[model samples]
Target: VSLQELMEPEAGTNRTAVAEFTLLGLVETEEMQSVVFVLFLFAYLVTVGGNLSILAAILVEPKLHTPMCFFLGNVSVLDVGCITVTVPAMLSHLLSHRPTISYGACLTQLFFFHLLAGMDCFLLTAMAYDRFLAICRPLTYSIHMSQTVQRMLVAVSWTCAFTNALTHTIALTTLNFCGPKEVNHFYQLSCSSTQLNELLLFALGFLMVGAPVVLIIASYIHVAAAVLQIRSAEGRKKAFSTCGSHLTVVFLFCGTGIFNYMRLGSEEASEKDKGVGVFNTVINPMLNPLIYSLRNTDVQGALWRILVGRWSLT
Candidate 1:
């Protein structure tokens, strides 16, 4: 159905129907817009290329076929999706004098963006649990994190993410707009009361962001405890090192995501918020592959094999 059908006012209501939304994207001045556009374009390219390389390395290398690597591949795909949903459109808008997006396009972007973002949280929590099992219960790690279990975790993550994104998108569609439909980080375009939307966002944000964060924290707590019980300092260090890349990514993603979503009461997007948005949307995705590659010997070796023509599906 069309956006008009979805977003039409009630029969008695006198609200203006919003056909499109003006995107006051990060910068205002032409000079700054050009500079931001170039930087974002470069960042987008790097993010896509880096994530693709990670996916290839995981697929090509037998050594990197563990549950951790499986989840890493999923993360790479989500990172690519997350960046793609927003950056390309933003880049095109940067070039336009009037950077407006149709109501349908805006909602579509919101759906995919939130879907992937929610998956990021759930997948990270899954990865954290994988690490916890490997470190804390090594004897049962293989049994608990079998191929079947891994796929189930991924399936659940995707299901939950789709539900969360769809809920928000549907909630937004129920609101009626009067005027001044400007979308910045999030669309607050409705002249109608957004109390339901805010409440819904807060509730699902807790489920998608807060609960996963708590689980991640709990998993790491157990992991730390298990690592500390190791007799050798080298063994403890080695155990903790396994978590390095995942921990870094968790901090970067959860930090910005919590700041952006948790404060549903705020209406104004500050400079700090925009900067955080850029980092979350663009910089963070590019860093994921780098973090995994540099910090992970298996991924590095897999990439090296591909680079040197030794990689084979066999």
Candidate 2:
């Protein structure tokens, strides 16, 4: 049997299976290409440097050895993995103007992209829970979020993200891309039409993405309620201060995700839609570490200490 026959058993006619796909990159202007290349290159470097520095600070600093920092470390790792999947290839495509990506590489990129994104969602919800427990149940927080329990939570987050990505990968593998080999976005692996794969993607989004968003919303609701219960002005101010940074990060990440994937099956998407999609995938990962570091006093202090220590040794 031919590859097309193998892919589509019910089809009465035969067709050619697409072996390669062309990615339509962000812009086609020759003058703009060089400018975009330099700008994206700078963004990519800052992304890698900021995330790695955060990870290093968390690891080397004893003061940051807490559940929150542990989760932050995982977020940093996810950010690095997320950006690495798309930015380098995107940069290459921008510079070379040859937008061909192999089937295997495309799939690999899609897999890691979804994996890291799902992991970030899970981790953010986990962080919200951590903050909730710290504020609401101060005395029992340590007991509830013990080392073993925290480790288990992190492990479960990774496992669920991997499984979610695997489901999509398997679904895509079953699809037969027989025509329209040009992908109208920066990536090609996401364009295949396997009903099973799309359904799986929707299912994973509902369970992993939808569920966590609900939990995050519920968490902040409770957090807001708790903050309101505080009678003293000082107490309310402190509570709000504690939550402001996390709330900002959560809104930025989840807002983009909801805008991108929530409208996936809709017919309203256009080239501007794809541009927004690319923005979330490429820019958000870079922004996460910067937002956390610049806004969170704990992270900033840890980063400063690390810098000072390094300078002293040199």
Candidate 3:
């Protein structure tokens, strides 16, 4: 039941808490739900497999052992984590009558969702810096992004993401869910006592999610400035092309994930909004490896040799 109903008809009543929550599925219609379910299933499969492939390529190919590929591997792991936390559970709830999720489970999802989401933000920013250093200041790129330093960057990103998730989870747990235990949208933490909850939610979206987007843009601006100094058109074209895929990913992730988070309280979460959420959480991960990184000359070359070389052995 909703937290409101379980309360003592008095404000600030946290004694009677909601034990479980009913999460919203993407669509209610049988046909639409089925279609979305299959789509999500396919997306999840592709997300996991595609990301794994990228990770594998990075690991197996000695040529991809640079700081760029190293950071990309971390991104792949974060992408997989981001999608896995939502899609599997969502798929199971597609048409089920028992759509109940325990309060603990809900918090678990919230924690990991924000955790990976935040990691995605920082990792992208870190990647942007990696790109900047490589393109803008190539001489110092190796010095700044040594294996030890890159590992530290990944660790710091992990710490920040964990802290963000922890804050959101703790903040959510303090609030009482009154009545109507059914989650109309995926799941949202609501507070009846104070306005602090809203501020906390907004901070997570803005500080953790929005902040990184800004940093990325700023980093790209610097990169662009440095690229313009190069006299050769061919040289400039190559630099921009290298950055194109990353820019595309930054927009896609921040645009949809932040939109869904902001949309939670403003309107009734419709199928379309849920679809956007799914795309952000599920399909985006799949698209990154497929559309962004997989088609790169380096990755493509590695895959070709692996596949074609295997045929020669056969």
Best by lDDT: 1
lDDT of 3 by residue, 108-194 (tens): 987998888888888889889988999988998889999889989889989998998999788777776663444455444444663
Whole-structure CA lDDT of model 3: 0.78
Say which prediction, candidate 2 or candidate 3, comes out ahead on lDDT: 3
lDDT of each: 0.85, 0.77, 0.78
Q: Where does candidate 2 have its weakest 10-residue lDDT segment?
A: 1-10
Q: lDDT by residue for model 1 over 1-314, one digit each (tens)?
A: 01112234646766667766666667669999999889989999999999998999999888888999999999999999999998888888887766777888988998999999999999999999999999988899999999999999999999999999999999989987763434345545567899998889888888899899999999999999889889999998888888999999999999988887764456665678778877888899999999989888888988888877844554
Top TM-score prediction, candidate number: 1
Relative to the unseen true structure, what is the C-alpha lDDT of residue 22 in candidate 2, on a scale of 0 to 100? 62
Which residue ranges in model 3 land beyond 4 Å of their true spot?
1-16, 95-97, 179-183, 186-191, 309-314
The clash count of every prediction, one per candidate, is 0, 0, 12
